[model samples]
Target: MVTSFLLLAGLGVLVVATAGVSWFMLNAMAPDVLPAFSTFLAVAVGVVTVEVFLGTGLVTLGAFLYNLSAQYSGGVEIAVTEALTGPPPANARALLLMARARRRLRTHIAPGDPGAGDRSSGARPARAQRETE
Candidate 1:
């Protein structure tokens, strides 16, 4: 119901806007030619009517198709797990900051660079890289 109402409202606004622009353009080109306001109102109403019927039909069709598919393929599976509750460790903030800084700093290393550390492994000791630098 909510989806249908939203779809109808959105498309109705679009149709009305388009009709208004067309009416404005036609009136600007030739004033007092056709009943432009009435025509614009008619077109907007007609389009919105068609949109409501088609939109509702399509939504129903989609729902039917989804139900058919779900029967064959077990639908979506959601897993829920309880979070661990406790006060964080004393050095939690410092530890997290160090990890974040290490990640950001690691991006500067080049592949196969001497004393940079094994690419397959991870960062080498500072003592090893200090002499090379």
Candidate 2:
């Protein structure tokens, strides 16, 4: 989505530059038609600018609308399973533990609770231990 917007912006700039160069060349080669050409060039640039901005605005609005609708519709679901391959690296386990700890802290810790150091004893509370078992 972001890539598409960037591409559109790049193309718009390229087209505007081309049009400006063509206008300049026309004025240089045929000074007699400069007035008429200048008027046409101004109108062309205005139209292109408006069209580009309008298109960009519509795309942005569409993305926001989709996000809002997805929030209500439960956007997407994904299922993941551990590979049957050999055990993961040691660092992988540490990273996974860190991620889980972060999630649990966010949901379980009170606003004024001391740091996670207090929970580092490696012993789950009785209720949590029971649920896991």
Candidate 3:
């Protein structure tokens, strides 16, 4: 009976470990998910950061769907093609689509985005603080 219990417990731990590894792999493959994951942990430790979880989630979902579609449709490089092409000059539709993409990214949490911070005020906070003092 003791031997049987030990076997079952080992099996349970093995199953849980396998599940944890699979979950890690899935998240690693998800687009923009790492930033959100780090942000969540930071928030738990009282650090505030804009992660744009909804935007990142949507992007990840889209990437998942795109990968699924590629498996069915002989694969296509959609994101890379869009970025490298920088919108087709002759096609108004492509330009319009690119414009919308730019606007969406601008409003969302894009890492290293220069326009991310509020720039209406001419001076940065440190300079303002010095002036006030």
Cα RMSD to the true fold for all candidates = 11.0, 15.9, 25.1
lDDT by residue for model 3 (70-131), tens: 98999984453425654467797878888999888556644564434666745344434456
Cα shift from native, residue 36, model 2 (Å):
3.5
Model 1: per-residue Cα lDDT at residue 35: 85
Regions more than 4 Å wrong, model 1 = 32-35, 75-133
Sort by TM-score, best first: what order?
1, 2, 3
Clashing pairs in 1: none
Local error of candidate 1 at residue 53 (angstroms): 1.9
Q: Please write out the lDDT profile of model 2 over residues 75-124, one tens digit for every residue.
A: 85332345676456997898899999999867764555444346686655
TM-scores of the candidates are 0.48, 0.39, 0.23
lDDT of 1 by residue, 8-107 (tens): 8788988888888888898899999858597768878887988888888887777777778877899953323378655378678878889999887676
Whole-model alpha-carbon lDDT for candidate 3 = 0.56
Model 3's TM-score against the true structure: 0.23
Each candidate: what lDDT? 0.75, 0.70, 0.56
Instruction: State the local distance difference test value for candidate 1.
Output: 0.75
* Window of ten residues with lowest summed lDDT in model 1: 76-85
lDDT winner: 1
TM-score of 1: 0.48
